[model samples]
Target chain A: MLSGKKRGLQSIEFLQAPIISSSASVAGPLESKSSWAEDFDWIMEDYLLGESSWERTETKVLQQVIQIALDKQQLSFEDIEVFLAGDLLDQIISSNYTARELKTPFLGLYGACSTMAEAILIGAMLVEGGFFTRLVAAAGSHHYTAERQFRFPTEQGVQPAPYSQWTATAAGALVLEAQGNGPRVSSITIGRIVDMNQKDANNLGAAMAPAAADTIHRHFLDLNRDSDYYDLVVTGDLGLVGQDLLEELFVQQGVVPKPNISDCGVLLYDGIPEVNAGGSGCGCSACMLCGPLLKKMYRGDLQRLLFVATGALMSPTSTNQGESIPGIAHAVAIEI
Target chain B: MTPDSNEERKKIEEQEYQQLVEQVRPRPNILLNCIWAFIIGGLICTLGQLILDYFRAQGMSMEDAGAMTAVSMIFLGALLTGLGWYDELGKKAGAGSIIPITGFANAIVASAMEYKREGYIFGVGARIFSIAGPTLLFGFVAAVIIGLVKYLTMLW
Candidate 1:
């Protein structure tokens, strides 16, 4: 019971659960127009963030999110035991550079788009194991920065494929404490790398959908729970195509997950036109969870929910070398 | 681990990985992409022709009109990129955007704008050609090759 492991699935049931004490999220212009716009603590009028490059802007976002989260809790960076953060950039410079400025004990993660959830899962585990009392989990991604790294330069006038999702420019950070009045991290299901040989870098949704389904299925078997146990089940950024595929795969596997399943990618740009497929990137789900979803939990709107953050773990080098895209997903159950 | 074992393991993993990928990913819709590119690229070339015609009607020689049209089109492309409209077009046009001369201009200005924060000299001036540098380099190289061929044929 003290040990977090369950069955043979390597799942963690946080015996000494940690509370999601407080959180803050900041978004760029396009994300600010999403349904969760009002939930964001701050939204930049421009993507610049007063910096020259989108990479620098993303770093500024992570820095601001950490500071804002700390401020809301009436604490400082010194109060947190560790800062877990990452982003989609070369060498994860966005999080690396931001951590340097924050001056906190940092553990840089690179789960691609799943960095936020991975950070939170690890942060919650550490806190619940009595290793630390307070920790911060954060991640960020900028559309321009990501585009330049994974595809062509934004100004290169290269066209994206139809299934391509717009990389969301946003940053989200959460403060997890050993005990608090906020939501609790009940359990976590870490996913395996499920590469379905999707070679197209533009269509990340297809590459990542299988990973999401695999993780969700594993979470159910490990916990020995049915779909009705949770109010809603959501994926990171499956977009329109991935969402459809996820539903089809779940049915094929005879795993009828709660029908309320939705993707942050599909929701981030609901009415925003021209954002083909939908929103994808580390920020897509991170911003949604930290902003709107957390607000709903605070208002007693949702008692239990599953947040399965997915990531396409392919690099420019791998894709160019004709390697198929590998995808991973990590799920965490949160309850108020 | 031994080198032989490591290499063998890597090969097996790669093979298995490919098999897994085949199960999940759907086939790409290339027909749709071709249609979009065809329409957008045709429209851009048509616009260029109209610009050239207008300049020609204004009493300019055909050569002068063509040159002026190219200049104006390049200017329009750069301006559109600055206003962030070119990228919107790019999302739909795919190769269509890259095939046009305007797309070339868009590439230069876009890089310049992105690096503007680094300052005028190092950011804007230095990195301005990062995207278009190869295009210019090879374009001149090909022109020289073609010119050399024509001269050689005449001599023969």
Candidate 2:
């Protein structure tokens, strides 16, 4: 029912979802010894040395995105009505800090890895519902900062499994405005949490694939549309293992879409050689959407697209309680 | 009177009774605590070493191992936290668990567990950002400030 507006008359059909303008930034990995202690020290020194914490990194990325969008769009901070954001850290620190700087009304969201999509979906709804004219949906992640809080310090020596996805050290932002002439957010498919209690945290790709497939399948069902309509279907940060698992799952469900299915995790690390598999974390999809994908769209590389960001809803306590991990995925359709 | 007195004397008898109290308490086992500390701590470190070896075997550079090790430890810590074993082990060996990289992992998972019952919106979802949240905010602000400082310094 949503359509682009014409220049003359402000028809209801002309009212479309806001356009998204994105930006991103990150700190490089520290150069140090393989010992956990040394690694932690180096990361602490390089990234967290002067800053009070990692949440600042998320704020910095958000700020960068906002700065770029402000410059590109030639808009001021006061023009934005809502700032909806999320991150992987506890308490949604990235959004909070960034909100403080921008001084805009904020809606803090937490969908883990699916945070990017969740923010976008909410922003679109606000615009579609005629609540706000301009909204920003942003998310971010930091490597060393995340490492020190979620894992061991570099000083300790530990081994990572091959299946584990690297948390992308980046943040991305999108400025959505109710402009008539631009790509419109066509449809949104919210996800249900599916828990299967498979405790191989290293193989998160497998753990999350079923949920991703479920969401993707359900989105098509709800929209009653064929998969070939969109030029690309993207999932947030499943890494190589997750991508394979998702393909296999789709096949099992007798819903084989084209090979155009790509993952943000795989795309973000396209040029970065040392990065093992692909990206993970809340920022993975956020960065890709704002960075490469948006750039591609701007360059007229493709047209209609589907973005499904998936998340694993597992807590340390749930894992200990012998509870299975629940996965959720949300899909948003955008067209140029 | 003599007969009555004799009968009265013969009828007299005496008895004594005593009450005793016993206390029950568990004895501290130093050896047991020591064994747990050494065994669990050593095992965690060993697992980390094995991960390092695996990464090396897979042709990852040594430089990358440090980052990889932290990632592995996070997963291990999360697993241990989930299994209800890390806290028990941590209790048995205080510094042993606390000193390792897994401690941070334990903090994250433990904080997450504390808030998990609140549902995704306020529970696990909100808590995931607990420890890392502040760290990220500070890092981002610092980066921007640092960037500004560098820019200003260049101009000067």
Candidate 3:
């Protein structure tokens, strides 16, 4: 029913699928050491990025990644109609400050960790609905910045719970055009707020699992497709705990996706013990989509891909106030 | 069903999901954490004893030496916290580092350093005691209550 082209309840089958022209990912030094190092366009040697604050560095990383995405396409900021992006920081400052420098008409988003997929989904709809010609969709997160804002100061050295996730220090940007030579945004399943009344902030993977399950379930039902539809189904940042729970949830909902399903949080850090369970933050799925998954599509290793970024929609204040964490997941399908 | 019954069903459902999640949530090993806390905590006390003996050997009284040990331990903790080594030790040591005088110093220094970026007036000055404030408040109240009890018993 959405955009008048869908055969499903909450999806839009883009009449002319917008092409992902170019994508660029930047990683901090810590994340650069991961197995997917080659996927990123730039690996910052330090978290500072020559900036005094981590917030400034995060903004710079996103700004530079957007520029790199444009450069890869041989286009200027003026050529882009709008910039849609978000980050984990409060007020979406990283996206806000970056937009100030880029001087493009900006629409800031705040879907917590779901910002990446949300941006791409909305950008796709706008382009397909004949609102914009080309635009940049991006999301980023800085490890230190997220730490200071969400949990503790960078140097606190507090012993985290075993199931806690590490925030990824990375940024990813994609140039979506009306027509291009890259994988296409075939359709998207907009998700609803799904809260199971879970309240543990440290165990976010558990809190967010049900939401991921709900969205993926509705996506399958809406498309009238089974589990094997996507060659690869990746959820954003639901580490080890959430990954296991999601598979179990699918069984409960009768939406048993194949074992091809993987979580970006688990894959992003590659089982690094320092990260505890796995990686998180907006950058988790953003980098995965722009870096490794998109690369696989280009190489023909993957055809249909489901990128679902799930977010725990609760702030530190709400957590402190003993409110349950509500989770949301948006599923974006890409095909080559 | 009535609205009240519907709300009760939802609450029960939420509790059921929480129980299910609890089964899957990995738990920290209590035995290992306790052992680490004990051993690390003992080492800190030993360090305090060493400091006390050092001051006593310099011809100080037992009370003076005890006070000096507390000062030395607090200073060491503050120094380590400033250099950012206290937190690293705290991670492995757990309550071992947290229960000692050094750990007490760290609670303040860590908060101070964390808020230092927000500027001195509202940041460091106000929040330096943020982590340690509850402990100080309760500890003082407990001391006052004990003092009152002792005085009342003496009068009796």
| Fnat of every candidate, listed in order | 0.47, 0.00, 0.48
TM-score of each: 0.84, 0.62, 0.95
| Top DockQ hit | 3
Please write out the lDDT profile of model 3 over residues A204-223, one tens digit for every residue: 99889999988888888888
Against the native complex, each candidate's DockQ, computed on alpha carbons, is: 0.34, 0.01, 0.60
Winner on lDDT (1 vs 3):
3
Interface RMSD of each: 3.8, 21.3, 1.6
Ranking by DockQ: 3, 1, 2
Task: Estimate the Cα RMSD of every predicted model relative to the unseen true structure.
Answer: 4.4, 24.1, 1.8
Write down the DockQ of candidate 2.
Answer: 0.01
lDDT per residue, candidate 2, A164-227, as tens digits?
A: 6677666667778776445677778778875444565555666677778878887776666676
lDDT of 3 at A63: 90
Q: What DockQ class does candidate 1 belong to?
A: acceptable
Residue B55 CA displacement from its true place in model 1, Å: 6.7
* lDDT, residue A130, model 1: 83
Q: Which candidate number has the best TM-score?
A: 3
